[model samples]
Target: MLSPESAEIVRATLPVVGASLDTITTRFYTSMFTERPDLLDGLFNRGNQANGEQRRALAGSIAGFAKALLDHPEERPDRLLSRIAHKHTAVGVTDDQYVIVHKYLFGAIADVLGEAATPDVIAAWDEVYWLMGGALIALEARIYAQVGADDGRTWRQWRVVERREETPDVVSFLLRPIGDDPVPPARPGQYVSVRVRMPDGVHQLRQYSLSGTGEEGLRRITVKRVRGGEGAPEGEVSTLLYDTVRPGDELTLSAPFGDVVLEDGDAPLVFASAGIGCTPITAMLEHLVATGSRRRVLLLHADTSPADHALRQDMERLADALPAAERIFWYEADAPQGARTGRMDLTGVQIPRNAVAYMCGPLPFMRDVRGRLRAAGVAARDIHYEVFGPDLWLGEDS
Candidate 1:
């Protein structure tokens, strides 16, 4: 809770601070990285930084947290905080790092705000920062404890046992622990962070969903090589994983962490995806088949074409394994015979009355599907979504 004095100060300055958050965060990252280059080695995502997604996400989160505090003084933004905590824990963020962030962030705030950042204003914002930071630190500690991870020793060696090409651009890697320690258990929709040293001597990391049954002893992750166009640079880690890493190669990976997992229920389920977004949805289906779920499941997907769809065979096999599952597909290319030919349309599709829908895909695709689902009488809360990168879908009321 904020003190009355501080609350008034924050409420007064939020407009200005929010307006300048982009500049503040950009300056924060630039100056912080200039001094602490080690953070870029394996901790921070260099690609997200170069593309400005990280900056936007950081700015949005700070502004969002502040707005939530002012809007609901008695409540905390657990949803926003929990999502961030999971991502931070996945990358082995430690408590001390928060202090470093505070120093640089406040300096950037002062730099951007100029003389308006008076002592009282600075202190009020400082309190807000610590409130958020403390909450994240506490949540992250609990998550680390839940996952049984050492404070800073989160990385483990995994050897690739098999690599299969799912599509021309997507591949799946099967990995086994290099040591005798058993692989940690993970939920169906969780993801693991894979860290690798690029040719330039910088260590880079990327998160790939656990695309198979989250079983013990082995793990599988699907990677889609990102070929950049229209000003976006090629994904460094993904390109390396595609062209260099192979069976018998050793890689470093973090323990699984993601909030969007298959919940225990008998309610009907709607699993939807587009392009490579099918990874987590595939995992969810694999879990359902493993458990012999008799619940009605609607499996929907969209892609450029059958030839471009990753894990197409796996999807069909899993859907067939479920006695009550219905599979639907949409392709950009001409529909072959009975299949639909255009983008995903749920216009005539019959969704279960009480189904819980989970979707992962491009932001635009997810937004469109979400609107249609809501119009079809599905509660907004019942429709869950996951974005692959920095959540550009930040301001949406999802």
Candidate 2:
């Protein structure tokens, strides 16, 4: 916990860091990798660094922590720290390295603020950082302890068990935990990080949500390699996971974690997903059906081409399985082979007027989908979306 005065300093300083995020993040990572080369192996994506989303994520986390601690002091930080811990876990971040991040970030604050950053202000930020970092440190400590508990044999080494081409660019990796020990169960709609050595690009980290129900005997993730721009390659991690990473290869990973899910409600539930954004949504449906929920459900998905559609056969299975749930698929390709042709049309797709909308996708796609949902007269409180990156594409300023 931080003093209110210290929290105020943090609230004000976060705006500074948020505005000039790239500088702080560049300094932060530069310090981290230069000081500790091991992190470069699988904790970052140089290609994704060009857009500076990761940097923004770091900045946002700091800002959010200050706001949450000040706004909700009695709150335990699990709801806040667990998400970041999962992300860090995906990238193999340890508690020691988290401390290193704090050292450089505070140093960056001094450098960037120069004379304006007083000792009191610095002290304030120190409190804020620790409150947030301590939350993450504690969470990571528990996760690592869980990993270490069973003689270091539990979940220590992960091997690729099966790989399937779900869509053209999107591939699903079915990973089976192999060891003398047992594999712990993972919830649906959570993600795991995969590590690969990229010669063209630096060693990178990317996350994919489990594409199917967990009891399927293997954990799966669907990946769509963003290309052309500065984000990801045509293959990116996909090329590495598909071509380079063979079965029986060892990859370190964090346990499954995410809070994004179907909330309890009698009102109609609307799930909207675009591109490869369907991964978690798909899992939600599987979980929903497996649990025998009778709530009215609507699934709306958008994709560029038929080749890029995810889980066509399984979606068909879900459609048949869930009597109250109806799925809507929209393809943007010219030759279109689905129910709806072209991009997601908020005009054409009629969501229940009172339905709670859960959405996910690329930034532009989300912007349009949200705009359309609003245009279609959906209430603001009902529209929920998650931006895959660090960027805030949700309520308020978004």
Candidate 3:
């Protein structure tokens, strides 16, 4: 619990600090990589100055974390801990890393604030950092312990047992860990970090949603290698994983981590995904059928062409299995084939009035989906999203 006076100081400083978020985050990252550049191996992506929504989310999440602490220390954000856990896994952040980040981050804040950061004010922020970081660490530890357990019921790891290109650009890998025979469990909407040692010996990390249906022992992730796509630099790990890595390769992985898995188990679930972002929704479709989620479910996937429509056979199989269930709605932005022949618009279309919505993909796709969902009168809370890069949705420097 924060002291009443301490909390008051936080409240007073909130506006000014929030306004200066960019400065602090920029300084923090600079300080971090400068001191411990080696940690960049597999952790920080090789880039600077966030672009697109990725940049926005990174800045937003950092500022949001602080704002949440200062503003609502008593109520506590339910998804906050889970969000941090997801971030930890996404970036491969560890216990020691958090300490380093917080140390420099707060130090930078002090420098920026100058006289405003009185000793008392500094102490209050300390409590806030520890409290928030403690919550994140505790949740992270619990998630990690799922691995390295004797019981097959818990988490499991797998080696890159095989690799195959299903299409020219679409590649899939078979993971078979030396540990547990049965794969560790993963929620439908969760994702895993695939860590690869770079040519320069810098371990690089990238996240891919598990394509196979919660297959713990033999998990598979199919990635559509974007050749210089989406600001994708000479993808440090993704390239090697695609071009060089062979079967029997070893890579460290975190357990499934995400907050936007299937929810509203009783209500109808609507899945809208675009491009490669279809991975998670595809898993959810299989999960819904496998778990016998009787609630009506609709899958709306947007792909550019017939070849780009991933898991068509598997989705068809799942849909066929659940013949009596809801429905499978695939919206293809087929450029080459010109199938649907138009952009997706739920305004006058297939999205059910009462369905809960989950969407993923590029920024434009998400923005379009959100507009359509909102236009369809979906409640704000009922719609959720998962983003890549950085935590960027909280606030901007308005």
Candidate 4:
């Protein structure tokens, strides 16, 4: 809980701080990375930084945490914190990093605010920062312990056993643990961070969803070669894996860490995905099939074309194995016989009542589909979503 005095101060200055968060965060990253260049080598994604998504995500989180503290003074925002904690643990973030971050972050805050950043104001926001940071540290510690990564070690060596091309731009790598260390159990819909040394001799990390169940000492991850468009640079780690990684090659992988997991229940399940977002959903479907689940399942997907959809055959095969499953797909071109044409439209589709939905895809597609699902009577709380990269959807109004 925030101290009463700090709460009053935060409530008063939230508007100013919120309004200037982008500037404050940009300055924070600029100054921090200038001094701590080592952080960029493996800890932070340069692509996210170059495209400004990382800064935006940081701004959103800080503002959101502050707002939540003021709105719900009696409770901490565990949901928000949990999501962040999982991501932090995935990247092997440690407790001491918070202090390093605090130094530059508050420095930026003070620099940006100038005379407006009085001691009382700084103290108040400091309380907010530590409150958020402390909660995350505690949550991350618990997660590390649960995953048997309490030794402050998150990465393990895994050798690629097989590689299969799923689409023109997508490939799947099946990996097996290379050491005697027990592989941490991965729940369906979880992801692992793959760390690779770039040609520049600096290590970079990217998280890919476990596309297949990690069973029998094997795990699978699907990678899509991200083509640069607009102003964003192409994905460095993905392209490297897609073009070079093959059988018998070893890769560094983090223990599975993700907040979105397939809930275990017999209730109706709705899995919606688009393009490469099908990875996690595919894992969940595989789990369901492996467990011989008889629950009603509805799989909805969208893609540019049938050939462009990764794991298209796997999705069809898994759905076919389920007794009460229906698959619907939409393509902009080359729609299959049973699939729909153009973009996904749920106008005439039947959605089971009291269904729990899991969605992954582009923000626009998820937003539109989420609205349709809400209109079809699925509760907002039942509609869980996973974003592939920096979750810009965090503080957005649903």
Q: Point to the candidate with the largest lDDT.
A: 4
Predicted candidate 1 versus true structure: per-residue lDDT over 1-398, tens digit per residue: 88889999999999999999999999999999999999999899999999999999888888888888888899998878887888898888999999999999999999999999999999999999999999999999988888788775678999898999998899999988888875668898999999898899998888999999434578899999999999999988898899988999999999899888899898899988999999999999999999899989999999999989999899999999999999999999956665688999999998889789999999889988988888878888788787787876654354
Which residue segments of model 3 deviate by more than 4 Å?
47-58, 69-73, 89-92, 147-167, 179-182, 214-216, 229-232, 247-250, 324-339, 375-377, 394-398
Q: Per-residue lDDT for 131-237 in model 3, tens only?
A: 77887777777666664332112323467877877656677787776763545577777888776666678766677888774345567787766567665555445
Number of clashing residue pairs in every model? Answer: 0, 0, 10, 0
Model 4 regions lying over 4 Å from their true place: none
* Model 1 CA deviation exceeding 4 Å by range: 214-216
1 versus 4: better TM-score goes to: 4
Comparing 2 and 4 on lDDT, the stronger one: 4
lDDT (0-100) at residue 34 of candidate 4? 96
Write model 4 residue lDDT over 93-158, tens digit each, in one string.
999999999999999999999998999999999999999999999999999998998734889999
Q: Residues 21-61, candidate 2: write the lDDT tens digits.
A: 56767787777668877656656676556566677677666
What TM-score number comes out for model 2? 0.82
Candidate 3 has an lDDT of: 0.67
Which candidate gets the maximum TM-score versus the true structure?
A: 4
Q: What is the lDDT of residue 196 in candidate 2?
A: 61
